[model samples]
Target: MNPFLIPRRPWTRQCMLPLGARPGLGTAAGNWQRLQEAAGGLPVPGPATLGNQPRLSGDAACCRVTPRLDRPKPLVFSAMWVWALLPILLVLWGTVGFWLVYAMAVANGSVNVTVVFPYISTCGSDPPQSCIFGQVMNVGSFLVVWISYLRFQQVRDWGCPCALNTAGLVLGLLCALGASVVANFQQNNQLETHLFGVFLAFVVGIVYFWVQAALTQQVKPRHGGGWLGPARFCLCATGTALLVAMCALHGLGLKSEAAICEWALTQSLFLLFGLFAEDFRHIESCCVRLQGRAPSPALELGAASTQTLAL
Candidate 1:
């Protein structure tokens, strides 16, 4: 059982060979002495002989020196994701929840989605619909609109032209606040008030994005100037076309055509935010300002010369 012990079962009888008065007895004794010496030379391995060493086998000697470690798989909602990404995701989820309630209402014949021109609040006009709509609006926009306002602040801090930046920031705040008003006041009960909120949010919201887009072009930050460059112009153009189409359809007394255009335009406005996805790095906090202008090429040359002269 022990690694150190030598096998003796096969050799037991041989080991006990008797020395007696017989022919060639002395020669046999010498042979037995030589056999005992060879047995003593056989290797006996033990733990104490080698400190925690793995026992060698066969003709090859190999060693494994290090221990292997197992690491856990990464999670979806890590700390950075929760803090920087969650607010944006929750805002989207909440907005989608509003549409989900609207769909349910349409399914039940409580409201018509396509031709009726129902305001978003109309989804929650009745008892059960109100529960889903209210939670999504109150809880979801609660994070989203404020986050929009903060993101607008980052636009300003990018060192955009003063007047333009202030205008954008104010419009963004109005958009956020107006959405809250629309959420709180049901269109069925307070139609005028809800309409007023819609005007503030929808109209001002576009202006805010326009301003943000202008800022995007003027003062570039490290994270700001990627695919967003082309996306800004495209979204603006698409939104403008949708707005014009909505107006023309409404003028022609096609209510459904106009309403669908209005809904698509709203989605286009949200898509503008997608263009600024770079701003997400600073979403939970304010915009960061770099200390000074990057040294001009001329200044860089001068500094290089100075260093050379010193050397």
Candidate 2:
């Protein structure tokens, strides 16, 4: 009999092979069994079959794993956080200092004429009213500065080198305090105090300007014209003119109350203008950087172009 027809040792009990079985059918069967064992004893589906299929340990079904995509990190600057707190501290100092001056003025009298100088008569003989006016002006000035600094800080995204800027701001605050002290002493008819107060005010004004210029340099350019440049020029000119007028009036021995008052008002206006200019410059610079365009030179030159027209 032929080997193909003859039963082997393990297949002796079996009478016949299944359909589609070949001469090497036993070897193929052994291979299929091994493949099933590798797949965790699960039945291997034929390529022609289609339906819900169970997952196998060594099957390609688990090969559908997806990889995660990485996102870019945000850029963070160290300087921005440092400068953020400086303005808050400055505002607090200004509030406390102004309040103290007001309290002191009230304690001395209803008004404080000693602080008003030759312009004392402008507010009448009441010293309390003059003191109150001075206090109001002081508070207003502080508010303007605080607001401007905050605007600048926001636009720059850079922190003030706390050590340098804070020192300058503190010095300016001290000078303002000194001025108040002198004014109070002078009101009490203390000539020495009056002179000291005037000196302190002058010093503070100078230091304040210096600090402003230094801080302004750090502001990166933005969109729009340089509004601050012209404004700063105007302020410097006005301030110089007022300083000259004050000195000239004093030199001529003219006790003109109006002249003194004008000098004080002009000085205050100059300071306000300077502060506004610095803030505008910072904002404009920030805008320019974000938009990636240079500010128009013609627009910058023409002051009228910078003005926001009201409807």
Which candidate number would show the highest TM-score if scored against the true structure?
Answer: 1
What clash pairs does model 1 have?
Answer: none
> Cα RMSD (Å) between model 2 and the true structure?
22.3
lDDT of 1 by residue, 1-311 (tens): 10111333222211121233222244334443443444465432222333333333332121111213343344332233334454456547655886788788888888765557764566677767877776665664556565665565666666667788778767867876777777777777798988787777677777777776777777766464566756777787788788788878979988777777887886787667555445665444433344555789999787545433110
Task: Give the lowest summed-lDDT range of ten residues in model 2.
Answer: 1-10
lDDT of 2 by residue, 27-143 (tens): 334433443444353344322231223323331121111123344344443443333344444445444544455455556664455654334323322465456545544554464
Clashes of 1: 0
Task: Please report, in order, the local distance difference test score of every candidate based on alpha carbons.
Answer: 0.60, 0.45
RMSD in angstroms, all models? 20.6, 22.3
Error of 2 at 161 (Å): 6.8
